[model samples]
Target: MIIRLNDMVFYGYHGVNDEERKLGQRFIVNLEMQTHPETDSVIKRLEDTVDYTKVYAEIREIMESRQFLLLENCANIVADKLLTDFPLIWKLKLCIQKPSVPIQGILKSVEVEVQRTRE
Candidate 1:
């Protein structure tokens, strides 16, 4: 089954510039994962599925815990953590968006996406 979490926002200190790291900014996270349950039948228990509340908490913790120099690193970190935390997940796709990036031109946001699979 596929589970998706979209537009989870958090304030984080992540950037290449010193000012950006110090001032921090808003970030948006989107996650999609494919999990295999032990049984193909309908999920009757929480243990039969990935608990997304735990997933959100873990993502939030990762975002708030440290400073990343790039969104690519941030996305990768999240993907790695999720894969480790939930072994049932066979594949994951994640995106991190920075809405208040420092740029001379007007733009909506800057985003980075990473996809991973368990081997």
Candidate 2:
């Protein structure tokens, strides 16, 4: 089965630049997770699957409650936490978007994608 959590937004300071870190910015995250179902469940249910709400809450807590030096580290932490907490999930693809980025040229948001798999 496949589960998705899309466009969850957060306001936090996560960037390489000092200004970007001090000023803070808006970030958007999209997470897609793949899992295997149980063989003998009487009824299929979301509760038995990965909970997107819990994932979102975790991400929000991580982003808002702490300071990170880089988006890469933040993404890694999120992926690791999700994989560790959700045993049913086999694979996860996480995308983090930094909108209103601190750049010189006319461009859109910059994003980072990370894929993690559990044994």
Candidate 3:
């Protein structure tokens, strides 16, 4: 089974620039998780599957807890926590977006994607 949480927006002070750290910006998180639910059985109870609300809470906690210098680092932290906290999650793909990048060019947003699988 798969669980996807898309377009989760949060304001976090995560960037290499000093200004960005002081004045936070919006961060969009997209997480896709592959889980090992009972394939042959019905998911009658919430515990039978991954609770996305709890997953969202964890992600929010990670994003809101501290400042990060790079989106890659943030993604890594999130992936590690998720994989560790939820053993059912066999794999995950996390994407973070920075819309207001302090770059000298026209762009939609700066995005970083990371994929992790449990060994």
lDDT of 3 at 61: 89
Model 1's alpha-carbon lDDT is 0.90
lDDT of 3 at 16: 99
Return the candidate ranking by TM-score, descending.
3, 1, 2
User: Which pairs of residues clash in candidate 1, taking residues 3 or more apart in a chain or in different chains?
Assistant: none
Task: Give model 3's TM-score versus the native structure.
Answer: 0.94
Q: What residue pairs are clashing in model 3?
A: none
All candidates: CA RMSD (Å): 1.5, 2.0, 1.4
Candidate 1 lDDT over 1-119, as tens digits, reads: 88999999999999999998999988999999987654436667888778999999999998988899999998888899999998777889999999998999999999999999888
Q: Judged by lDDT against the true structure, how good is candidate 2?
A: 0.84
For each candidate, give its TM-score against the true structure: 0.93, 0.89, 0.94
Clash count list over all predictions: 0, 0, 0
Give lDDT tens digits, candidate 3, residues 7-114: 999989999999999999999999999876544266668877778999999999888778999999999999999999987788899999999999999999999999
Candidate 2 deviant stretches above 4 angstroms: 37-43
Q: Which stretches of candidate 1 lie over 4 Å from their true place?
A: 37-42
